[model samples]
Target: MKNIVIVGGGFAGLWAGLTAARELDLHGGAARITLVTKDEYLTVRPRLYEVFSEGLRAPLRPVLEPLGIQLQLGTVQDIDRQQRSVHLSVAGGESLALPYDRLIFTAGSEQRPLEIPGAAKFALNIDTFAAAQTFDRHLQDVLRAPDRPGRLTFIIVGGGFTGIELATEMRTRIRAHSDAATARKARIILIERGNVIGRHLGANPRPAIEAALREAQVEIYFGASVAQIERDAVRLTDDKHIDASTVVVTTGLRANPLVAQLGANTDDHGRVIVDEMLRVNGAHDIFAAGDAACAKADEQHAALMSCQHAIPMGKYAGYNAAHDVLGTPLRPYSQPNYVTCLDLGESGALFTVGWERKPEKSGAVGKQLKQTINTQWIYPPSGSRESILAAADLDGVWPPAV
Candidate 1:
């Protein structure tokens, strides 16, 4: 029997493992599929900004075990491509090596923390389940402490997707922990180094985003950069100070550093460049997906580091890996359609379509759609192999047929 090893347990890793098992099962091939990761739970990363609770994580065993995919909890220390083995640092500082006939690299991305003065010490982020939970506890601490100036103010560093969602929802989160008057007194401020908001999202949805920000009463500091983060405020590069009790940084994300260990050419974000079949450009018997691989979605756009792209990339990469081991044909990966559904808290949400991001829905309708996606669509099917495999199909419709 051949060994198929997958790294990471997030959306990409989970789906990749499932898809690989499904492919092998369809062909009646006996292959041992194992998914290795640092944690036992699949963190719903997109919802980390919304609220921190146990609901944000789903145990992998309930999903992976029924599919015959062994779950190994550990940190992948290095990949020895020459030896066809992955070195891992498991619990109690023990080391183990797993030789693989085929390797799927799904090691996901991480928050790109800024290297400014006091940032490492004073700034907080909701980049992961643990981090979000820490921030949630900090919010409670804020409520317990005696009243002070700027006690409820939150400074969001960036105007991108995560920053925008967190800023707009800050007040609502506060209200959940305190009174309406306290929530009303809270200040949500967004600081962007760029001149305009949602700079990367293009101009098509700017109007809706701006209106949502205005409705949320989020103050925008356009073209302003934070020089340093203090215990209770952030100092701008221009020597100006914005006092806020809490500072949340949403700078952006970088691909897992393990991509470099494969000795493949990578993009600026440290994502390995892969071929059409999602194989690492210069490596053998190894494939990459999710944030680890910079795969092209189409001729015009490359796959973004989001759930929208990661899920499909996982399916394709998994299928191609199985096919390679089975000496069968591999399918080329391509996703032409793109969409963006941004949650905007009390002002509702914004849903757009295509690479240009043309507005398709907004306000209540968009919020409902966003809620469904965050609460239902993104989670993996559990406790049933049939249902899980069905969801792992290669030609599955994305964004659903609504």
Candidate 2:
């Protein structure tokens, strides 16, 4: 029996294991699959911007075990491609090595930390489940402190998708903890170095985003950068200071560091460059998906570091890896369709379609779709073998006609 080892337990890694197992079962090929991750639960990373809760993660054992895949909890320390092995540091400081005939890399991305002084020590981020919970606890602690100038203030650095969502919803999240008057008095501020908010989102969704920011009463500072993040305030590049109790940095994300260990060509974000088959270029018996691989979604576009691309990329990578091991023809990965649904808090959300991000829905209608995606679409089926495999179907459509 061949051994297939997968790294990470996020959306990409979980789906990759499931899809690979399904493919082997379909072909009646004998294989043993193991997934290495730091935790058993698959952290719903996309929803980390929202309130931290039990719903932010799904147990991987229930999903993987029923698919004839084993789950191993460990942090990957290194990938030895020459020896075809994965080195890991498990609980209690012990090292373990997993050898594989085929290795799938889906380690996912992490927040690109701001290099400014005090940014790392003071500013908080919601890049992981633990970080989000830490932010939540900090909020509770802040509520206990005596009301002061910057006590109820929140300054969100970067006006990108994550920053916007967190800024607009800051009041609502605060309301859940304190009185309505306290929530109403809360100040939410957004700072963007660029001239326009959501510039990365393109022009199509700009109007809606601007309208939503206005409705949310979010203070916007365009063409400005944070020179430093202090304990109780942020110093601007222009020497202006803004007082705030909470500061969040959402500059962007970088591909997982494991991508560099393979000695493969990488993109600007440190993502490994992969061919059409999701196979890592210049590496044998290795494949990558999600944020770890810089694969072309189409001739015109490369896949973004979002769960939208990660889910589908996982399926293709898993399928191709299985076929390569089985001596079958590999299928090229192609996902021409792209969509963006931006949640703008109480003002609702903006849904767009295509590479240009043309607006398709807005207001309450768009918010409904966004909620369904966060609450339903992104989660994998658990405790049911048939449902899990069906959801892993290679021919399935992304966003799944929802």
- Write model 1 residue lDDT over 186-228, tens digit each, in one string: 8889999999999999999889889888988999998888899
* TM-score to true structure, per model: 0.98, 0.98
**Which ten contiguous residues of candidate 1 have the minimum total lDDT?**
393-402
lDDT of 2 by residue, 1-402 (tens): 888899988888888998998899899878898999999898998788886788898888888989989999999999999999999999999999999999999999999988999987998989998999989888888877997779898888899999999987888888887878888888889989999998889888998888888888899998898899877888998888988888988889999988888899999999999999999998879999998899999999999999999999999888988888889999999899899998999998888999999999988999999999998889987647888888888997667774
Against the correct fold, how does model 1 do in TM-score? Answer: 0.98
List the candidate 1 regions with Cα displacement exceeding 4 Å: none
